[model samples]
Structure formats: C-alpha cells, structure tokens
Target: MHVVITGANRGIGRALAQGYAQAGEDVTGTARSGDDGPRLDVTDPESCAAFARGLGDRAVDLLVCNAGVYPDKGQNLDTGYPPEMWAEAFATNVTGVFLTVQALLPHLARATAPKIAIISSQMASDSRAPGGSYIYRASKAAALNLGRNLAVDLGPRGIAVGIYHPGWVRTDMGGDAADIGAAEAAKGLMSEFTALSLASTGAFRTWDGQDHPF
Candidate 1:
C-alpha cells in the first residue's frame, strides 16, 4: 500500500512512517523541511498542491493527516488564548488537514480502496469538557467535524475516512507523563487504518481500536 503521512520528522508521524516501511509498504512521510521524504506545509495550499503534483499519477492508498499544533497547551483561560494563537492553531490543525485532503483527493481516488486517517484528539470531544487550551480543543473539534463530513462525501467514491485519538503519547508534544509510546500508537493506528472501510467511514476511534465519544 502507498501511504502518505504528514509531519513525519518526529513523534507519532515519524513512528508511523518507520513502522509502515518496515512492514514493506510504500510510505511517503512528509515534513515541513523535507528532511524526511517530501516538503509539505499543510498550512499552505500551494505547498500541498505541489506535493500532490510531485506524486504524479501514483495512487495514494492511504492519506494520514497527522500534522497539528497545540499552541495554547498551558495557557490560562482567564488571560490566555490570544487571537494569534487561535489562528495558528486552526491553520495547522484544522485548515491544514482540509488542504491536504483536498490536494490529494485525485491520488486517493486512483486507489482501489482509499483510506484517509485524520489524527484528531480526545480533547475534541464535546462530552468531556475540562476547559483550558481553548485553541487546541476547538481546532481538533473542527478537524473531527471535517473528517465526518469528508467520510459522508467520499464514501460513495470508495474512500474511507476515520478520525482517531492516538492516545497520550510520550513525545515532545505529549510530554513525559503520557500513557503510551509512539511505536505502540503507530501499531494500533496501523490496524485501525487497515480495518477502515466504507461501513465505518465516519467512525471516531481510539488508537487501541475502541470507539471514542464525539
């Protein structure tokens, strides 16, 4: 399978790339600097378009929209979450995913069974509100909604879309106190991506293959 993953310089994106490559799958892991495979700034429309063009007529069996930002991680709700931070967060986490998907839609359509994996967070869940990090939470929620709608629209075209929480990973972004490692998350996500089909196109799931509340 040919897989395209974004933000693969480090963390879970990197792990997913390594795992897939080891499994003998064709993997294209993209980073902003192009240090990994290709240069893909999901926040920029032209960047995404150029990356797709570089792929030529090759099929993208899987598209993993994993690039994201948590700009207001520790910001206080009373005096934090500035408008600029919100803009940055949405640009990377929300619009970025959409642009990546839009740019690669043709490549995905060329595949026999295309699958789009959107790496969202449990923070996006409206049912589990704890406040703080307003920008990250709101952006993730937007990403989740985007995946849902994309699944509906893309299902008839033989594409499957799934939004998932990669779990609290012990990476630079997740901190040292997280619950899982990048490898473990990648393994589970690989299975989730493998199981994704038109039947469960809009499913919101955890990395461990459990259903996640929207």
Candidate 2:
C-alpha cells in the first residue's frame, strides 16, 4: 500500500513510517528536517497542499495525520489556558489535517479503498478526561469531530476516516513512563488499520481496535 505519514522525524509517526516501509510498502514520510524529505509544517496550508501534490498521481492508500505539538511548558488549569496556545494547537492538529485531507482528496479518490487516519488522544474525549491538557485536549477533541464529520461526508466517496488513539505511547511526547513502546504502538495501529472496513468509518478507535466514545 502507498502511505503518507506526517511527523516522521521521531516518536510514533517515525515508528509507523518505518514499520510500513519495513513491510515493503511504498511510503512518504514527512518531518521537520530533510532527513527523509522536506519539512512539512502542518500549520502552513500551502505546505500541506504541496506535500499532497508531491505524492504525484499515485493513489494514496493511507494518509496518517500524525503531526502535532504539546507545549506543556508550564501549564495548569488553575492558571487558565491562553487563547493563543489553543489557536496554535488547532493550527497544527486540526486545520492542518483539514487542509491535508482536502488537498489529497483527488489522489485518494483514485485509490480502491483510501483511508484517512488522524492521530487523536484519549484526553480529547470528555468521558475519558476529568481535567488537564487544556489546549492539547481541546485541539484533539476538535480533531475527533473533524474525523467523524469527514467519515460521514466522505462516505459516498469510498474514503474511510478513522480517529485513532495510539495509547500512552513511549515517545518524546509520551515521556519515559508511558505504558506502550513506539514499535508496539505502531504494530497495534497497523493491525487496527488493516482490520478497518467501510462499515467502520466514523468510528473512534484505539490502536488495538477497541472502540472509543465520541
């Protein structure tokens, strides 16, 4: 399968890209550095659009929206999250995905069964989190909604949109004490993606295939 993965420099995105590439699948992995290719600053619509075009006429079987940032510099709910932080988070985690999907729709349409997967967080779910994550949580929650809405709107186009939580993965973002390793998380995520069908569109799921609440 031909796949496009964002944030490939490190963490879960890097692991997933390596996993697919190791499996002999054609893959395009984007990162901030030119180590793989040019930087994909997700906050820039032009960058996202250009990246989609870079895929050429190849029908992308999967597009993994994995680029994000969690600026947990000195955060606390008691201090209140700033609107600028929220905006920054949304620019990368939500609007970036929207633009990426929009630009790739044409290429994706040519595929037999195109899939769009957004890397979401369990903290995004209102039912899952009692508090914290402030800006990051809000942004991911918006991402979930976008994925679900796309699932409905793009259903007729034969594209499957899935929201995936990779679990508490041990990455730079996840910290050292995270429960799951990047390789294990990547394996589980691939398993879930492989098992996905048109019937499962609009579903929020974990890397292990467990259904999550909206």
Candidate 1 colliding pairs: none
lDDT per residue, candidate 1, 44-137, as tens digits?
9999999999999999999999998888888987888899998999999999999999999999999999999999999999987988778888
lDDT per residue for candidate 2 within 15-91, as digits (tens), equals: 99999989999888888565765567787877877776777788989989998888754597678677888888889
Give the poorly placed runs of model 2, Cα more than 4 Å off: none
The estimated TM-scores of all candidates read 0.99, 0.95
Supply the TM-score for candidate 2: 0.95
- The lDDT per prediction is 0.95, 0.87
Candidate 2, residue 79: lDDT: 82
